[model samples]
Target: MSVNSESVAKKIKELPHIFVILFCVIVLSAIATYIIPAGQYTRVMDEGIKRMVIDPTSFRYIPNTPVGPFAMFVAIELGLIEAANITFLIFAAFSCLYLMEKTGAVDASIALMVNKTKKNPKFSIGLIVVLMIILAVWGSTGTLSYEEIIAFAPIFVALSIALGYDAITGVAISVVPVGIGFASATVNPFTIGVAQTIAELPVFSGLGYRCAVLVVMTTFTIVYVMRYASMVKKDPSKSLVSGIDYSDFTIDDARMSTPFTFQRKLSMLTLFVGVCVMGYGLIFLKWYINQVAAIFMIVSVIVGIINRWSANRIANTLCEGLSKGVLAALIVGVARGILVVITQGNILDTIIHSCVGVLQHLSLHVSAIGMLVFQNLLNFLIPSGSGQAAVSMPIMTPIADLIHMNRQIAVLIFQFGDGFSNLLWPTSFMVIVCAMVRIPLSRYYRWIIPFYAICFLLQAAFILGAVAINYGPF
Candidate 1:
């Protein structure tokens, strides 16, 4: 093959679009039902929490209930139905953030921040660090979806560009910290909460250790991102997204020269306050998806009125935002669709049980590491952190007991496996961010691998330490 032809072939060999990947997984999961035996564990109420948990000693294989080819298509719709709440939450959150973006307040604020600190690279780095920590904390709540953050992509892209960095740096500024924070989840309701419940451990216990993990991961991500951002700013050609038509995400001269008006500041203030309030509601009010949706809607309306946007204009912007999220929402449903097939066919537990059984003979510390590996691999099939916890924790809890492993360590391993990979996995919410910013999935995978390696090492070390010290309350 000629050189040009070779380049073309290489391009063709790149990973398929996320939708295609998810669809193929859905089909394969449906087919696997026939091969993987159907089995379930009996559930019993935990005396302290009054939550039903799998009785570790009560698992038994049941008759296989394999899904047919036709049923595979049905699983897609069922997956959408199962994921409806999160889907709608994504739509609503995107719409609200879209409304704020349309007002140009957030963009203006980002531009202003960039301009004020552009002269001081360290100051600009500090800005990136602060934004990352905030986003990471929000992600740790386990309630913020990638869709909610998608609207901020353009703003950060513009900010990074203004700081003489590239679009990929902007994307990293927006997502990498959240991914790290997510991996080091302390009180994350989705992973920690669900896994603890299933494991019959006190919810959010063992957080001291998790906090330490979070600090290390967040600090490392900040350094990694700052180094890359500085390198790109020094030489734009070094940027991953160099030569891409990212002008759409860049702040033009006209936008930059424009003064940041008081109305814009207040509008930005409203956005911050809204997020703070939402965080409060999530942490204290015990809010879920619907509540998050409602809060975003309310905030959008308030910001709209503050921006003096007429009802008709606000309505149009909201619709446009919702449209932007359609791809992401569909992606969520399609990814969830694979889980639906595996779940409805009753093979999820079997898969977990079988994997855990393999770890039975390993040394306890190695078994804990094996559990982390299993959960990490399983996360590819089931990207939803809470869903994976629901499916795996029941079996893992018992395995922890059988192998003399601390249940809290098991939950910690689950948290690490379920979350750290979201940044790396193609079939995950990270794809939604990629879709929003037009970042190719493969490019993101390449950019994130080193950081992910560091995270994995940290997580393994933490898990091993947990095992050694018996990190637990149970």
Candidate 2:
């Protein structure tokens, strides 16, 4: 592409038009409600329908209401809540990241990496890719922050700059790889674990399938990010510039004169041990993950104070970082708002009831595949893997058993539907993360679309083939 074309692409990549896209989706859905005649069982509920306009105050209720012009109001309401929750978490994560930076620990680590990578540039890329896979595997074990952009973002930026790539490439690689890991995770606390547990299946029972998906998705993410980075390296104009230079990220110009002190080393050890313990509590001991985050945050703060850092400075840094984090968080609300509007307008119910009604008519043999397809389609509306699992599993599991469909296959259907769509969904948390890092949705789609398409087909084929081969959970 020419310089002007690359500049245009960069601008398009940074377009913060989620709200506008959502507005259009709401309009299209509303039009569909009328133009696409409702199937026999898909009747809209007038009483549930609430009409309102999109605004800060009303966006939170959008996801729960019925479909129509009024449904837009509901979307706005629900969007607000989703945005708020994500924003809060991001703020908290950024606070932790800032503390890590302030203590000079982050710098020291970077120096070690730079020294190592300076010996071999290709080794650096390989190391980053490997780390991404490791972090992803850790994520699968139901450990580590699924939302790790704050920690990884700066590191990747520094690495990219060090490697002679632009900041955008760093941000893209940092967020995308981990996101694919989360999406493909079989043992993720939020989705797979929760879904399987709810279905009464053994925890981590489908490890083989999940691992296969994870490997495929992770390879896809790494290849795409590396290619994008190469493109930006070849032509800087292709990279989005935030008007910030590499030096702006420097925590301190002076390198650590003293060797790693016992205190600093001790502090690092404590943080590592604490995190591992917290993960143990969360996964094996049945402790809540939020509780783990809270404890870790508290411990990190204590470590900061003990390291002789000024409390006031730490607080200010955290606040500054959090403000940036909140901007990224708001996109979640915009996406969720679309769902709220549709639900409020009763269109979601109309669609679901219609699908179920149709399923009732199909022969049991076909119904199995039909239900799987139906669940995947619903993922478009409900992008949250956990929320979708919660809502769908209860309704689909018994039906699967009743129709003699393998329950394991039914569960896999939910997993595939939830996992794969995450890559493409505009509203998913991972997708918003990509946008926040200025990785154009179109660019992401360009690279991963083929991989995801293949994965989807493979998953569908696997499910159907299982049925054909008389594969049963027993």
Q: Which ten-residue region of model 1 has the weakest summed lDDT?
A: 45-54
Evaluated with lDDT, which candidate comes out highest? 1
Clashes of each: 0, 27
Give the alpha-carbon lDDT of every model: 0.80, 0.63
TM-score of each: 0.92, 0.76
Clash list (residue pairs), candidate 1? none
lDDT of 2 by residue, 42-157 (tens): 22212211211112111121222325566566667677775564556566766676666666666676666666776876777787688778766675564554454444576667
For residues 1-474, write the lDDT of model 1, one tens digit per residue: 899998898688567888888888888888899999999878776554445656667778999999999889998998889889878988888888778777777667767777778666578877888889988877776656464566567667777787888777888888667777777777787678778877778888887888888888888888898898888878888887665687777777777765667877787788778877777887788777788778788888888888888999989999998987898888888788888888889998788778867988898978988988998989988786766776678778778888888889888888899888888776777787777777777777778888788888888998998887889873
Model 1 lDDT on a 0 to 1 scale:
0.80
